[model samples]
Target: MAKYSEKASKKVEQAIHTEKEGKLRTGTGKKVTSRKQAIAIGLSEARKEGAKVPQKKD
Candidate 1:
């Protein structure tokens, strides 16, 4: 597995907390109703910013 940077981890952590509190929202205004979705969003953002390596699908 590839390692995520501290910044990336922090974003994901915040998203997880927000998801747990039912306050997570995506950039397009959609609510993050699932933990997995929130984490995916964070990871995608990190990838976009070049803060973390993206996972390759098998």
Candidate 2:
């Protein structure tokens, strides 16, 4: 896995936890049901916060 900043890792962890608890949601107000989606959501949020995350692979 690529390296992620502490903040980014924390955000992802929080997102995963929320997902496992069935509390995560999407922009369309739909429930999050997949772990991969949750991780993507976390990375997206990390990008928003300017965390030290790598660029998306092509």
Candidate 3:
């Protein structure tokens, strides 16, 4: 199990909320329908903000 920082967790939660509200979109401007995709988006944002997120898996 990979460890995520508090900031990362919060970001993920916020993303899920946005997804549930149909406000989350992908880079291509398409709606995100998958929970996993929402989680990925959250982690990506967290990484950009310098949160202590684990390295992306290959």
Measured by lDDT, the strongest candidate is: 3
Better of 1 and 3 by TM-score: 3
Ranking by TM-score: 3, 2, 1
**Candidate 2 has which clashing residue pairs, if any?**
none
Candidate 3 stretches with Cα past 4 Å from truth are none
Report the candidate with higher TM-score, 1 versus 2.
2
Root-mean-square deviation (CA) per prediction:
2.3, 1.2, 0.6
Instruction: Give the per-residue lDDT digits (tens) of candidate 1, residues 1-58.
Output: 6787988998888779888898888889978888889888778777778785557457
lDDT of 3 by residue, 1-58 (tens): 8899999999999999999999999999999999999999999999999999999989
CA lDDT of each prediction against the hidden true structure = 0.81, 0.95, 0.98
Task: Identify the superior model by lDDT, candidate 2 or candidate 3.
Answer: 3
Worst 10 residues of 3 by lDDT: 1-10
Instruction: Using lDDT, rank the candidates from best to worst.
Output: 3, 2, 1
